[model samples]
Target: MEIDGQPLWVAPSIYVDSKEQGIISLGHRCVLSEHVMLLTHDFSLDRYSEKMGIAPSDMEYETKGKIRIGDYAFIGIRSIIMPGVTIGDGAIVGAGSVVTKSVGDGMVVAGNPARELGTVESAWERNQAQWQLKRRRP
Candidate 1:
């Protein structure tokens, strides 16, 4: 569900890591592009093999966290939103970036690790500068 007066758009192909605890959340008017992956859990087996350690499938409780995308946030295509990430309002995440840490409000972050590039002046300006609201013909 979307917050009042804020519309959320997520691509059809967006994949959630798990069907059960895929507790990825969106505040309002968030835009998630194609093939975006919301990763909610990480397995111990990924680090420790079954030969030496517990398998990921065997583990019941794993490292998991919720992802919160604040209002008006734009997540670019094919980006991976890791567990325990909070993307603040009016933030712009560049394409194909891996978000490891929380992003502050109105911040523009891009790259492999997704570092801070700059801050947006205002929500109005950020929306105007970055995205557009267009109407389709009937």
Candidate 2:
């Protein structure tokens, strides 16, 4: 759907876990792959809940911060992005990766902690070459 000129696709199963508010800002054409989770809250085990006067539910806690995914970004399937993260423009998060930090623009990252796997420029160039080769074949 288009929200103020930004196209966002939130998967039906995508869960936004937050307390105060859950904000998912998808820049132009930001696609939230299947089973992707955007978390906005966190609670310490030692912390107490004001309502229950007891430990808070693991899924229910005060919001830590908001999450913003930049423009033209592709998040692979089953990626879990933690609270207070701003994923830079054109960044790609590989599938099944746990993102604890903000991703830089034009970078492809993967793995549990999400380390930089490659630069966007290199990946683009490689894709272009492959496209050209395929074009020449037919």
Model 2 agreement with the true structure over 1-138: per-residue lDDT tens digits: 123246456578877775343365667867788999988777654355635666545544455767888887888899999988877888889999889999998888888988888987888877775654444221
**Alpha carbon lDDT of each predicted model:** 0.81, 0.76
Over the stretch 51-107, how does candidate 1's per-residue lDDT look in tens digits?
A: 655565565546888888889999999999898998999898999999999999999
Q: List the residue pairs that clash in candidate 2.
A: none
Any runs in candidate 2 off by more than 4 Å, and if so which?
1-4, 19-22, 47-63, 127-138
On lDDT, the leading prediction is: 1
- Please name the candidate that would achieve the greatest TM-score relative to the true structure: 1
Candidate 1 structure, TM-score to reference: 0.76
In terms of lDDT, model 2 sits at 0.76
